[model samples]
Target: MGHGVVLAGLCAALLIIATLAMGCGAMPIRAEDVLGALLRWIGAHPAQGDDAIVLSLRLPRVLMAALAGAGLACSGAVMQGMFRNPLVEPGLIGVSAGSALGAISVIVLGGAASVGWLGSFGVTAAAFAGGLLTTALVYMLGRRRADIATLLLAGVAINAIAMAGIGVLTYMASERQLRDLSLWTLGSLGGTDWRRLLAAAPWIVLSLAWLPLHARALNALLLGEREAGLLGYRTRPLQRRLIALTALATGAAVASCGVIGFVGLLVPHAIRLAWGPDHRLLLPASALGGAILLIGADTVARTMVAPAELPIGILTALLGGPFFLWLLLRARDGGVRA
Candidate 1:
């Protein structure tokens, strides 16, 4: 299929899923009601309780999920292209691990009582900082060698250290702290609101904006760094920019929604399977596919257990795990090549 056709289909699916997502939950609004509320909000109509629920509660959560998913999936596609490995993802590079450590520190060391004062933005900022710092460290370690394997190893080491730090934090946590930390690690969009969404938007948007502009560079890099440089591309600078952008995007996503996994790893690969490996098409299609998958997952999470919602992370992991195993088996069979 053509890139345009694939993109159109993904966007259509995202729109449909998002509309369904807006209507699914404990209260359960209809699709028409969801549309009516959105149109009314657009037209500045007077607010009612149901409109308030749809506009104030569900809309922000849905938008956050879509943005976070798109950003992470695009980052994953870039990482895979840069590393020249189909299996590479945002988490494999330690961004999520570092972000988790940062969040754990805030929740455990700062204490539950402090959350009222610290607010959601405080935790988000710390997580973002941690993700960027860890990714930068990994970049520094790998820059001297300029080897993909070395960079991957550095990320692995950093992720191990970050996980250790999280373990220590868990050990030291109070009951309330432990509860909050546990929930955050599991990941959910339940507590999301306009304020948290606004806080994360700029980083995600800015990072995504930088990605498509580098599509040609990413494509060139796929031909190998030396060849890309011979073609007059500044391979090293491109790598640095891509890594920084990935850190910013992934950090904002982890900060906003906690550690939702698999979208990044799974969405890009799925898009590649259907749309071919052209970075130009891959990045945008992955973004749309990610949005659709995440919104659909979030809808299932909310409705599956009714009043009690499943964590979005758990749902993604459950779905992605089997696919991951299949990839491994395919690789073993020598049928998988990226």
Candidate 2:
């Protein structure tokens, strides 16, 4: 209804969805028991039976989804603000493609499952590195400083190159590696554990914390570059910093979760349409909405096709595709009105 009301609702929804999510799936633990597991988790006591399942299996996955969703949705919100385009999503800037290439490289060329935790470690680092490298390259290639279009075009070029690189890797991959690579592209939280969660958490957390600090700057940018400059905000540096932060955050998400599609793409827009566009409200609201959306998506992904988990990406894409079409049609209607 209103900003604070919306924010409070989202916070409550996230908690409920997260708790329900932990309790869903094959074992179907009760929500209260799930709460008990969480409360007992802090004591460092090794939980047995359902407690173990809740703590060891579900908790990390749910938290990962929440963090990834938060980072991605926040990034999408920032990117949309920077470009002033409702349809713009974080992946349009090459973070997902770059992260995909990095992970694919590891699965196809670098590691074997037999190598223990090091393999997962390699994939995570490589994905993050790939994202940062792509960001730098995009900034360099698209370095018109004041032209947002150049940066976006640069991202397109990088995405193509990275996709081609992924193609080559896909061709060279062993059967098992190919399967793994394909799944990575499709996205999932199946491999999530505390170790994997910890790896990407800091980047997501850093971006979540740091990105919102620039809300006022984003608000300024909404008024056009010249106007923002008149207001004492240097548009170029601000845009660059926002992109970098969003990339780091989105990159970590893509790396860890493989390539979740729509949370980043749609969540921010949902928040904006329902709650309005003040970044002070929009940013945090997007974060909570993202978490709730992903947790819900993931729960359905794992359950709807029980015993066989659907790739989370596919589920989000399926849901996002129609919503996106609605957005386009809504824009068309708005144009007629104007």
RMSD of each: 2.7, 3.2
Positional deviation of residue 309's Cα in model 2 after best superposition, in angstroms: 0.7
Which runs in model 1 stand beyond 4 Å of their true positions? 110-119, 136-157
TM-score of each: 0.90, 0.88
Candidate no. 1 TM-score: 0.90
Best candidate per TM-score, number?
A: 1
Q: Per-residue lDDT for 188 in model 1?
A: 83
Q: Rate the local accuracy (lDDT) of all candidates.
A: 0.81, 0.81
Question: Residue 110 in model 1: shift from native, Å?
Answer: 4.5
Residue 38, model 2, lDDT: 85
Q: Pick the lDDT winner.
A: 1
Error of 1 at 285 (Å): 0.9
